[model samples]
Target: MTGKNMKNDIVNKKDLKQLVIRFYGKLREDKILGHFFNHVTPVNWNEHIKMMYGFWENVLFFTGDYSGDPMRKHVAIHKKHPFSLSDFTHWNKLFIETVDEMYKGENAEIIKQRAQSISTIMQIKLFK
Candidate 1:
């Protein structure tokens, strides 16, 4: 792939869905983050994953399918368990790892960048 043609490497909805599923699969077994999804909130994985698919699709492709207050949701979760900067750091790290493992394109880079930005914003809002 050449630098000039890199912009053409767009991510489709199927790829986004796979990324969401695979990332959550890792999160479910992750030592640091697993408890939040498996025990703390006891997530309904089907519903959550479906929502995430929509969310990421909207975020990456501008599909406009997601329509919930993610910040509010995270704030409520934080109130219950108090996430620290390390948590955000770890989350972003795992996210980047997941994206890198699956893709190498403009959309992949954009996704990682957006995840980092979102993690930073969440940390500021929840911790400070």
Candidate 2:
């Protein structure tokens, strides 16, 4: 099925991989947030995508295949460029939109909720 049609179709490793890759594709092009990935460090797309796959898999499925200090990384990035509340809002919007467009189910809801929670914590930590 087409990627959009895949929404709510199924949740699994392969589908989660697609969701992450597709989401990042849109995220990297976003006007408000694009610079972070595109200009901040000149992202290694393959590596980033791989790491994201592991992250989402672990988050959604408890795969235990991902490990990293996301908060510390964001803190460093915030020190460098400073993400604002608006940036986090835009990120949440994109994250929800991406997840809703690609999947809809328990795991899909969990992803969106987790994104919201992550954004909330990041905002508090970065701006507090």
Candidate 3:
């Protein structure tokens, strides 16, 4: 469906969950990024998905629903298998595409911007 046909901003937790699930679905299937989640670190998807829902919810709405040091987790993963710039770039690309495909308006735009900013920060921290 086109953006015109699907005109709904990510307004609440339900929307956030849908976006997270869909975005991670793509991430799991992604060639470059998938290995990190599926092999490198081997995420427990059930818990991870719930964590991400809270993460994005807090990110967009400041709901204080999530609490975890994402950087620390990534740092540990980096020690196990170093992440390159392309990993972050592809992550941002997939995130933006997923958001664009599923949402629009203020929240959608903010989430994309935040995802990009977060990706950039992660690259700097991990690659530095």
Candidate 4:
């Protein structure tokens, strides 16, 4: 890829924040997932986005900016909406697609892998 056309790697919070914002934007429009956030859970976008930035930053960079129980939160959501296997699969697809569209490098790859792992773990715990 040339200089102007090439996408950069995720190197800091700013880049990760962009990824999160864009991913959520896509998620909010998705037919399968949009209802979960728009109606079922009805997230506070401002607060949720901020928390997600911290969450993902900590995940990718070990920044320790986040310190919440994500499992507990997801469990709450599951109680409300009851997640299916397809929900997790679609979430991972959108996440990986968003990451690939915006960035490319080690951190980008790591984030995608981590997302897959998270989805798998969450599914196992939530279903079992």
Candidate 5:
């Protein structure tokens, strides 16, 4: 199962982990979002990775292991600075590329489409 299989219509856990790792790897390298993770007080990268894995697990895999409020968390993060549409666009583009790089499955289209839809919805929710 490729990363595409773990998303959208095809859900799986391993693929979710791949997605999270790849996406965060890109985030760490990306100048736009890399600054946010600069201070990991205790620097427990393992715990941080697990937290992210669990979050994406719940989101992309429907795993019951995660039960936190992402919207609230996003709001908190966004409060530090305004997140513009361009930022979201960059995020979506990176996400799509990561997915494409890791997998090639039928559900890829669904995953990308839903991602765009949700990003737009979140932008609306975030802005107004």
Candidate 6:
């Protein structure tokens, strides 16, 4: 792959969106996260996907598409329910699985590592 082509691949956005959709598509059926969605607006599944895409894009690429602090959001979510490390570990695993099932590349590995790091950090903070 040439430099320009590699740049184009990284510029792609669908991977992020797909991961969000598939992850939540599962989350909507998950025993843990599913129940919490009861408070969600439920009218903006597409919007939520975009938000998640922007979030991962920014976090993994420094693109700045995401403006909110994910840790803070997780903390707020934790306030409503005690989030365990196992939950985040499972979430990261699902996220990585979705990405792997969708795309195969070095970028996928980067996203996986970042997701795991984020989940680990959040898990530690939530526990503390």
Instruction: Please name the candidate that would achieve the greatest TM-score relative to the true structure.
Output: 4
Off by over 4 Å in 6: 1-11, 40-43
lDDT (CA) per prediction:
0.84, 0.84, 0.88, 0.90, 0.70, 0.71
Identify the runs in model 5 with alpha carbons over 4 angstroms from their true place.
Answer: 1-11, 39-45
Which candidate number would show the highest lDDT if scored against the true structure? Answer: 4
lDDT of 2: 0.84
Error of 2 at 79 (Å): 1.1
How much is 84 displaced in model 5, in angstroms? Answer: 1.4
Per-model TM-score, in order, reads 0.89, 0.90, 0.93, 0.95, 0.74, 0.79
Question: For residues 2-109, could you state the per-residue lDDT of candidate 6 as single tens digits?
Answer: 654443223466656666788888877778667655453243666766787788778767674778787887778778777776777778777777777766677877
- Candidate 6's C-alpha lDDT? 0.71
Q: Write the per-residue lDDT of candidate 3 for residues 47-117, one digit (tens) a residue.
A: 88988888988889998468899999999999999988877877888888888888889999999998888
- RMSD to native for every prediction? 3.8, 2.5, 2.0, 1.1, 4.7, 4.8
Q: Per-residue lDDT for 1-128 in model 1, tens only?
A: 67664433335887888889999999988999999998777899999899988888877887857899999988888888878788788999899988877777889989888878877888888877
Which of candidates 3 and 4 is the stronger one according to TM-score? 4
Report, for all candidates in order, the number of backbone clashes: 0, 1, 0, 0, 0, 0
Worst 10 residues of 6 by lDDT: 2-11
**lDDT score, residue 78, model 5?**
74
Task: Order candidates by lDDT, high to low.
Answer: 4, 3, 2, 1, 6, 5
Clashes of 5: 0
Residue pairs clashing, model 6: none
Off-target runs (Cα >4 Å) in candidate 4 are none
Over all chains combined, what TM-score does candidate 5 have?
A: 0.74
lDDT tens digits, residues 1-128, model 5?
55546434335776667777878878777887666665422225566677878865555546637777767756776787667788888999998898787665665556667778778888888999
lDDT per residue (tens digit) for residues 1-128 in model 4: 69878999999888988998999888888999999889988998888888889889888988847899989988999998898999898999999889999998999999999989988998999999
Residue 74 displacement (Å), model 3: 0.7
